[model samples]
Target chain A: MVNAVTTGADAKVSVRNLEIAYGDATALSGVDLDIRENEIFGVIGPANAGKTSFLKALNRMDMFNPEMKVGGDIHFSGRNTRGLRNVYALRRRIGVVFPLPVGLPMNVYDNVALAPRLGGQRNRAELDVIVERCLRRAALWDEVKDRLDTLGSLLSGGQQQRLTIARALSQQPEVLMLDEFSIAVDPVTTMRIEDVLKQLREEMTIILVTNLVQQARRLADRTAFFLDGRCVEIGVTEDLFTGEVRDQRTRDYVEGRFG
Target chain B: MSRSSVTDFDRRNRDWYIDRLVQAVVFIGGISAIVFIIGIFVFITREGFSFIATEFDVSGFFLSQNWRPTSESNPTYGILALVAGTASVTGLAMLVAIPFSLGAAIFIAEFATGRVREVLKILVELLAAIPSVVWGFIGLSIMNPLIIEWFNVPVGLNVLNAGIILGLMAAPIMTSIAEDALKAVPDRYREAAEAMGATRWQVIAKVVLPAAKNGLLGAVLLGVGRGFGETMAVLMATGHSVNIPTSIFDSVRALTATIAAELGETAVGSPHYQALFTIGIFLFAITFVINLTADLIVRGIRNK
Candidate 1:
């Protein structure tokens, strides 16, 4: 297994030789990755490319499903995350936004404050700060602040997605992963979300999965293209987009010859 | 031209297909059943509503403490005691059944392991299959004696006995329906909760339960309605008292039992007969209201 540990480097996430299997099929095999603090990293791939699986393995969300099997080392802030048995603590450090806008049945305020409250922040003042601050960070506070008590499901689709992002941000996680967050929203909302992602990367390490190449080109500092569960190529976003003449597969994908 | 030309035998053969025949039968059968159920309700309301008056001294008849419908000069028919008794006992049964059923449902849905959960689910289904009459028999033969002797209760056949039997009957239904509700919750919601660093129990209590609240409320309302309308078990174990139930251990009569018991003995056109018919109407109306409330709760949950 490959191990890359740099001294004095404040990498928020360092995953080495990470392997994940679902029942008999191997979803990810011996993947090594690193995410520096305040950098937006995007995973670009077609369907069944193990992008979601890798994201899930980062926060140990797959453990809840009975059919998943995971292996290998994941390190967060110098601690081996594989040895971290507490899924709750692991999740607290790394927040995740699912593909669908799964707004809880509760009010918008509760949806954002749920993580903080579960993490033991109970006072009203602190909750109000977190809810407003996170919603503002998601760029949704102006629209939803007045109607905080309204049910989350009552919100429009784009607002619901932003609310979900705000909910994830309320945890104040060290790293945030979004799994195809813009697939369901309109083009204008997607651009707005991309803007929010750019702002969020200044404070939190962000890993995003998207099929849209331009979204990755716009927001991601580094982009990794995956072809059939393997990382095809990863480099600076501009290099991958402009000077990617080495890998023909990446070239084919970028040129839209084949996905 | 062949015998099976495109416009001739082929079209006739296509019309005789099994799928079309089956679809026709299913459509007709479903509509027929719906019509039959509506017809039953209409017939019951038509027959029962004729004897009911718009206004009367129902306060005395319903709110009275005693029910003595006799053939004497003053025929006393007070259903208030029975209605009150049914309400109290059914309320107690709901309180007992809800927690136990919800707890068991949460366990089966979220916590229980493979074989254990399957076994528990089967046992719950078995509990539902046990007839209400059998539950009454068990209440009489086993439950009542145990409550009286071991628990040192005053009497065997009382509101407590009926409540216990009704609670037992309602538990399985509530648990099964609540389990289905909990199961209906998409896995993504639970994952989202867990990813928020929520413990398993916390996920169940906070996220899962709130999401399935509508279904759970529906289950509870259904259980309450079932307990309210239960005739056989309440008739058997409630000791058939006409007095208002003073306590859990007091004997009482329910509206269903009152109708069941007096229908055969009373004269068809007498005031007593008419009052019993009115009691039938009242029972129907009470259950209808409870069911309507349950429907509203389910709809409210959906709106949420």
Candidate 2:
């Protein structure tokens, strides 16, 4: 356990003593954190620092891998995730965006409409409204409105990344988790998506896992520094940079001395 | 010194000679397939030519059911009944094979894992390796008695018995190919769909199946080809009666069986022998078309 500043009552997600392992190799362990509701929580770490593994554990993705073992408790809202009978219902409330854009092998309209359809929304008019609003919120509607029937994979890399954001938003989730969302986007597109994330913070709690240290500074209300499979420090985003940090490693990593 | 080094580098070694020899051997092996196919086609054409050019009546050969090649007087070679028998049996075989193989493929590819998956894969391969004659034997000894007892049909060996045997025979290979097709779909697509909260069934139905449709179609066509080309099982199980089948219980004859059964007894230059060769040509063309179509459909996935 690391950060004890936030209480469990206000936290959107409370994870305690979480551990993840694949076969014999442990990827992450002893992680404790509280993500407040409607706050942009940034997680910064280098490659293989278990940032991606942490997000995967949040949604119980270990079920797909027979060799992956997960232990300890993760509470979403107030209910314990491990005790839930239907994992699909739990996943529906938490949206995820991968590092590289995954524009499902479908048309743009259908891609954005997939999650809602999975949830049993069959009305065409309702689907149309949801698709438009999600795409618009991701800043992609105007660019793709004329050619909604084209394959989503045919779009430019930057556009596809935005399209992925639109797809994640389509679920209308309570928590939106993005893993290195801007790794494949241009600087300008990255800034544009950053603005969209800032706006999204008002509606949902956003967990942004980023490699860019400055990105955490720009948007996160509070940030947690992960190092070598452990959460090193958690504090106000500005305080971590300007004020004193408890761990020297957090300052060294944030200052770009070493990963 | 620089010139000497360049000359040494350019000199061919023993490895280069071995490489050339292996390439030449593989080239001959590759080209022999076309050579043998053409050779077989020419020989069959020559053997069947006299009957085709002289006595072959287009309408009677295709539309009439009479195949009395052994008659002392009228010796007609109409094969309508044979065509119908082959068509019916193959059609029924496909009906049984498609679902069984596709379901097995879905289980092996999507559901089964670790030791279970490995065991299932080996079992399927073993099933594919079983001799057609053994399947024919089972149809003769086992399925024949079972079908007669269950359905109370007069004939034990008939279209249904042969069709079921052929379908079971075709399923393992079809399952193997369909599994390969399903496996070809990238894991990322599955991961993405799973992350979106789609249930296991929903992920397969909505994403995986649509992506693998072409390959699945190819697998079915290959099974149809196998059913068409199969002879020993059809001969032993179908009772080899020369008739146009009306129902599943009706015993029937197939084109390949006719060639295999009669070619041994007919005199070399007799019209009876030539007529059998004509049936051979027809069987060859149909199987060729089916196999080529399967190949093309499977290739379509790679291009995309």
Candidate 3:
């Protein structure tokens, strides 16, 4: 029934009857959701729930995958993303952090500065400021400032994850989508990044996709539970854990009884 | 316990003996390569030793352009003209090959998809399989006349002709290696750069090229090696005149061509024959160094 709902002008991103398939294998079907502006929206799902496909669809990454077929309308900032002539322009406005860190085979300073450089900011002084601020916000500046010229791939796993976050932040995107950002991060660093996400929520719409239900409870204002390529329910994060969900499957999933 | 069921851990079975036999065979096969290389080196050194110890003039051998090795009154053994000819041809070949090979490689590795990629790869391998003599024949019959008509030169069998033929000869192999280097760059890097709003060209130029730099350099060096070692094509395309060419139209001779043309006519123990063997040693050493450097650079990619 939610798939039939009309779009709202207030929503930053609106998905309508979104269907994703990869070469005859359906990944997600009949999914409808609206992500509002400046809210920490969470997606909690088991593996193969099409959570990653949802993020990829928003940024138009399906262009790279010949087999991936996206069949629906997705509106970002009140404009249809599929109709845009320049997809790169649309992607620049939205940033994504993948499940695993990719350090871009460059140095630490260059890693964070890449997005801004791509945006045509050539002033060294301005770029240095942006790089330092992004790294500090990602909680990686202290460890990496002394060795900014060293290769980013040389960083440890957790440090690389934080560097990815810093790189994403440098875009100053209106929307930030992160898929399993804490998979390679230690618990202490995870908590630190969780704080960074909360601070970032005031400026951008944050979409956090994680398997950790407790993380959703901690950071998400509204959470959507996806299972078997479907969105089972979307509700207030606390309500899902408090047994106020519309579906029994949502309760079971949050309670760790079953996925 | 039954007699057949009794087990002895120390007993070597048939499979164990076969495995040991295979290990020994492979060891011999591996070491034979080094042995053969050393044997060839020793033979060449022994043949050329007499000339080097007696009448070899370092300055004249390297600097003198005259290579008259069969005059009764005054015979000389200078290779400067041959060296110039080889250097000029190889240099021009690189100029022609680098752009073509790199462009072909980028298309094959990054842009082409499915049937196009498969067909292109097969075509490139087919190009590489073409015989050097066939390439030389094309140069002599087809390119020679074309060059003379186009440039209005007195002769066409010169540096430009040999260089173009050699470049065409070397491009496919360079393209193959360069494509491998580009393919070896992880797809994750491209995805990451694309996610940051980089266009396709931007992703290649900024991320992929930098990551695959060492491998690409190795590919270029391998192409240089291929150019230097190519004998038949150079022998046919170059007019085989002994001269230090001042222009592309001037006919010249290569060291390999000189050896191939002269080794049969001269007596084995004569100074002229030994001089040709010395040139062989020089070529062997140069090619060995180039190939080793290329191999090391290619291996650097794996270490990263």
DockQ of each: 0.74, 0.75, 0.81
Error of 2 at B45 (Å): 2.7
Q: Which runs of model 3 end up more than 4 angstroms from their true locations?
A: A1-5, B1-8
Interface RMSD of each: 0.9, 0.7, 0.7
Q: Report the lDDT tens digits of candidate 2 across residue range B47-138.
A: 99999999888898989899999999899999999999899999999999999999999999999999999999999999999999999999
List per-candidate RMSD values in Å: 3.2, 2.4, 2.2
Tens digits of per-residue lDDT for model 1 on B34-128? 89968867765555454555333757766776577784766666677888889877988998899999999999999987899999999999999
Tens digits of per-residue lDDT, candidate 3, B127-154, equal 9999999999998999999999999998
Candidate 3 local lDDT, A1-259, one digit each (tens): 2322466679999998899999999999999889999999999989999999999999999998899999988988778787788999888988888888888899999999998998899999999999999999999999999999999999998899999989988989999999998988889989998999999999999999999999999999999999999999999899999999999999999999986
Poorest 10 consecutive residues of model 2 chain A by lDDT? A1-10
Worst 10 residues of 3 chain B by lDDT: B1-10
lDDT of 1 at B32: 99
- The lDDT of each candidate is 0.84, 0.91, 0.92
TM value for model 3: 0.97
CA-based DockQ, model 1: 0.74
Which residue pairs show backbone clashes in model 3? Answer: none
Where in model 2 is the C-alpha error above 4 Å?
A: A1-7, B1-4
